[model samples]
Target: MNIHAAILWEQGAPLSVEEAELEGPRAGEVLIEVKAAGVCRSDLHPARGDWPTRTPLVLGHEGAGIVREVGEG
Candidate 1:
């Protein structure tokens, strides 16, 4: 599925908003349709190079949403 995600391209850099292709969750995982996401300072820990993170990653971790699908175990 296509999703709008805030991608972190690099540390100390601006977040890039783009459309991303997301696969269904694996076993024991749940697919959530994100309804709300907050860009808090906690998310900035990695963005500011204070914490280590994988580059080109989807940045929203603290989000509220409904479960759209559930993967089988």
Candidate 2:
């Protein structure tokens, strides 16, 4: 699936809004159609280079969404 994501390509850099490809859920997983999302203090730690993090990271874990698909348990 194609979706829009906020990616931190580098430390201390602004997040880049880009198109991302997502695979279907695997075992014991579910795919959600995110309706709302939020970024908190923790989410900024890595973004601001206050903490170590890998590049090309997707942000915003706090979210509200509807389950779109479920994988085998």
Candidate 3:
């Protein structure tokens, strides 16, 4: 399914909000319909190149949301 996500294309670049395709979770994984996502200084680590992360990474880690779906055991 497609969902809105803020993607970081590269270090020192502004985050781009786009529709992202989400594959179904694997075993023991859960799909969350994120309601509130916080952008804290911790996330800046990747943006500043202090923390190594894959390009085009989804920016939000600290989030509060409801469980939309759960993968099978």
Highest lDDT among the candidates is held by which one?
A: 2
**lDDT of all the models against the reference?**
0.88, 0.95, 0.89
Clashing pairs in 1: none
Per residue, candidate 3 scores C-alpha lDDT tens digits across 1-73 of: 9999888999889889998889988899999988999888989999889998889888768999999899999
**Total backbone collisions for each predicted model:** 0, 0, 0
CA lDDT for candidate 1: 0.88
Q: After superposition, how far is residue 58 of candidate 1 from its true place, in Å?
A: 1.9
For candidate 1, the per-residue lDDT at 19 reads: 90
Worst lDDT 10-window in candidate 2 = 53-62
Q: Write the residue-wise lDDT of candidate 2 on 7-39 in tens digits.
A: 999999999999999999999999999999999
Q: Best-fitting candidate, measured by TM-score?
A: 2
Q: Residue-wise lDDT of candidate 1 within 1-73, one digit each (tens)?
A: 9988888899999988999889999999999998998878888899889999889877767889999999998
Candidate 2 off by > 4 Å: none
lDDT of 2: 0.95
TM-scores for all candidates: the values are 0.90, 0.94, 0.90
